[model samples]
Target: MGKLTGFIDYKRENKEERDPAQRIQDWQEYDAPFSDEVLSRQGARCMDCGTPFCQMGEEIHGATSGCPIYNLIPEWNDLVYKGQWKEALNRLMKTNNFPEFTGRVCPAPCEGSCTVAINDPAVTIKSIERTIIDKGFENGWITPRVPKERTGKTVAIIGSGPAGLAAADQLNQAGHTVTVYERDDRAGGLLTYGIPNMKLEKDVVERRIRLLEQEGIDFILNTEVGKDISAEELKHTYDAVLLCTGAQKQRDLVIEGREADGVHFAMDYLKGSTKKLLGSEVDGEQSIDAEGKDVIVIGGGDTGADCIATALRQNCKSIVQFGKHPKLPLVRTEANMWPQYPNVFSIEYAHKEATAKFGEDPRQYSIQTKRFVKDEQGNLKELHTVEMEKVQDENGQMAYREIPGTEKVWPAQLVFIAIGFEGPEQEVLDSFGVETFNQKADAKYGKFETSEANVFAAGDARRGQSLIVWAINEGRELAHKVDEHLMGSTVLPSYLEV
Candidate 1:
C-alpha cells in the first residue's frame, strides 16, 4: 500500500506522449518516461483497499480484469512510493518476465479493475512498472542468471512471440535446455514484426531477446517448424516441445474486387513495413506504399490503429478506419462495469496523430464495407460502404441492421484489411498431428498437453487470438506443466492457477 489517503491527495497523471506531429515523422517510441518523483506520486495513487483487485488477474463475464500475469502491483507500488527501486524491481520481476513489453503495448487491464477507478482515475500502474524495470536495467540491476545445473531435459518452443519467449525464459531458468525456433530472421515474432515500432520500439524487444540469449536459451531463427524442420524430428530430438506459434492465419475479406492489386492484409503490410525499416529482405513480398495515396483500413482494432499509424508515417494523403461495432460510450455503461476492461471510447496514439493532422478522427463506426471497387488496370480505386444500426430481432437478440439510403463510396488507392486472425497456421498444426477444433489447438487447459506424448501447446495456438498478457500467462503455465511432466511435480509458477 502507498501513503494513506494518497488516492485522495494526489491526482492521477500519466507520462505524456511525444507530440503527435513530431512522433509521426519517425518510428521511435512516443511515450515519455516518468521521473522518480512523478512515479512515486503516481504509485501513491494505489489505494490500500484491503482487497486489491488490481492484481486479481481474473475474467468476469468473458472480460479480462487486472494484470494477467498476477503482478504484485500493490507491493511494488508501495516500494516505488518509498523510493525502493531495487526491491520494487525484484517484486515486479517475480511475476512478469518482460514488463518492458507489457508496459508499452499492454492495454493495462489492471488499471481498469483498480478500486480507485470505481470512483476516481486509476493509479498509473503501467508507468510505474515501466519505470521500475527500466530503472533496474539502467542501474545494472538486471543481469543474466544462467542456470546453475542442467536438468538434462530439453524443450523446443516454436515461435518467438510473447508466449514462446516467456516459456523459454521459465524453462531455461529451470535448468532445461531450451531452443526456440522462429520462422523469421529475428527472435521476437509479434514484438519484432507484427507491432509497429512507433508504439513499441524494436530495440526494446531486441534488448529482452539479448537477455534471454545470455540466460542460455538457444534461438534458431529463420526456420519454420513444418518446413525447415519437421515436427517429428523436433519431438524426437527435444525431451519436450511447446507450440506457441500464435494465431497468425489472418482472416480475409471475401467481397467483390477481392483480388485488387492494392488490397492487402494488415499483418503483411505491417511486416513488410518493418522489414523495410530494418533493412531486412522482403523476399519479393509486396511492400506498402501509402505516400500520397488515400488509405482505408477495415476492422477497428489495435491492428487497424497500427495500420493508420503506419500509413501516417508514410504520409498517406488521407486515412479512414471502419468498424462494424457502434462507437463506445464516453464513460462506462451499466453493462460495462468497473471490473472488466472498460469498453469505453479512448483515443489511441494513431488517432491523436491523425486528428492533429487531418482535423478529425479517422474512425467511421457502425459501418460495413459492401465491396471494393477497382480501376481499369485492376488496381483499387474506391470502396463501397453502408451505415449500420443496432436493432433487436424477433427473439429479442441484438443484431446489426443496415440502414438503407445511407450507402456511400470513398476514394481509396490502398486498402488494408485488419480484421484480425483466425487461428494457428493449419500446416503447422497438421504437422504436429494434435487434435484441434474451432481453429484452436485441442489441449488440456491447466496442463497444456497435446494428444501426442511429450508434446504441448499454449498461447494463441491453444486459445484463439488473445492479449499478449494472456499469452504470457499461458506460456508460464505451460512451462510449469512441462517441468512437472519431466521432473514429476516441479516448482515453476503458474499464476493463473493461483
Candidate 2:
C-alpha cells in the first residue's frame, strides 16, 4: 500500500545474528537490529495481496496458518516504509500489548502464511516489529497510559505470566482495579525464570513490568494463591477472579533407576540458571551443576534446545539430545504443505551452538529412553535408549513402537526431562473447583466461567501449554468476555472475530 511496485523491486532481508562461536560465550541476545535505511527497505517488501492471509490466524490440518493475535501487519509495514516510527508503534500496540516480547520469542506464523513466502521471501515482519518497539522506548514515546475513569469493580488475577500480565493490562485500561499475584519473588513467571537469559534478558521483562506499575496495576509477589492466601478469601475479597496460572506439571520419565541423584526436571535446571544469572541465590544440594559433566537432555522441542545451549554455556563436558519422533525434512512434505505449519527441519540457535562446540548436532532422533542406569553412589551414570518405528494405531493414527534390537547406551550424570507439560498444576485448579474440558486445560464451549459465577480461566492453565501468541490471543479474548459479563456489554476488541 505504500508503493505500488515496491514488492517487485524489494527483496526480503532480516537482522543478522552474531557469529555462533562468539555469541555463546555470553548470555546476551545474538540478533542485531537493522539500521533505519535497511529496515525501511525491508518494510517495502510487503505485497498487496487481495486477501492477506497472514492475519487470519487459522489452524489448517493440525498446523497454524497465520498470526494467532492477528496483528495488523500491512498497516504497520506501510507506516514504517514512510518513516513513521511513532505511527508504526501505535499500530503495533493496537492489537499486541507486548510486541517486544512476541517480537523476540514468537515463531512468527504470520510470515509463513505471507503471500510473498509462496514464491519469494516474506517481509521481515518480526524484525520491523522489534524495531518499532525499540524505537518507541528509545524516543521516550512509550509511557504508562492510566485510564481516565475507574470502574467500581476490582479483579484479582493469579499468576504473573504472559497471560496474567495481558489480562491485567486490559482490565486496567478498561477502568477497573487490577492486582496480579505471583508465586515467585519476581513478577514474570517463565519469562523471569524458565527462559534462558541469552534468549531474553531479565531487564527487558522488568522494564515492561515497571511500565505496568506506572499505569496503576498492583503486583503482589512471593504469594501463592491457594497456599499463602486461601481461595475462599480471594473469592470474597475481589469482584471476580481470573486464573492465569501456567501449565507447569512436568511429565516424568518413569524407568529403572529413575531415582538417581543427578536426575532433575528441565524447568528446575532452567529456573536455577536464570536465578543465578539474576543474582538470586539457589538453595544448596538441589542445585544443578552442569560444569564438567556429561549432560543428556530428553525431548526435542524448544525447551530441550534451551537445555543443550545452557549446558554448553555452563561448560559441560558434552551434550546429547534425545527425541522420540523422527527428524523432520528440510523442505515441506506432502503431508505438511504451505499455508499450514510445515514439518520442515531447521536448526535452532541452541542446536547450532551445540554443533559448533561439540562437533556434532546434539540431537538423536527416533530414539526413546528405555531406562536410566545409576552408579554405585546412586548418581545417574548412563542412559539406555532404543530406536523407535512409526506404526499405525487401532484408529489408524501413527504411534511410536520401540524397535526390537536397537538398544544402545550413552554416558551421563545430568539428565533434564523436557517432554512437555500436561496441564495446570492440580492444586490451584482443584482449589477453585474448575473442571477440565476436552481432556486438556482449555475450558469447554460457552463456559470459560468456572462452576462458580464470574470466575474465569485462560492461557496455559486453561488451554494446556501452548505458544506465546496463543497466550496473548487468550488474554485478549478473555478480557472481552470478562468485560461483557461485568457491564452486560463491551467495547474491548476481540481478534478472533476481527
Candidate 1 whole-model C-alpha lDDT, 0 to 1? 0.90
lDDT (10s digit) by residue, model 2, range 425-494: 8888778777763323233232457677768888888777888887877777788888878878877887
Instruction: Name the top lDDT candidate.
Output: 1
Error of 2 at 38 (Å): 1.9
**lDDT (0 to 1) per candidate:** 0.90, 0.85
Model 1 residue pairs with clashes = none
Best by TM-score: 1
What's the count of clashing pairs in each model shown?
Answer: 0, 2
lDDT of 2 at 282: 82
Tell me model 2's lDDT, rounded to 2 decimals: 0.85
Which tens-of-lDDT digit does each residue in 361-438 have in candidate 1? 999999999999898999999999999999999999999999999999999999999998988888887898987734
Give RMSD (Å) of candidate 2 vs. truth. 1.9
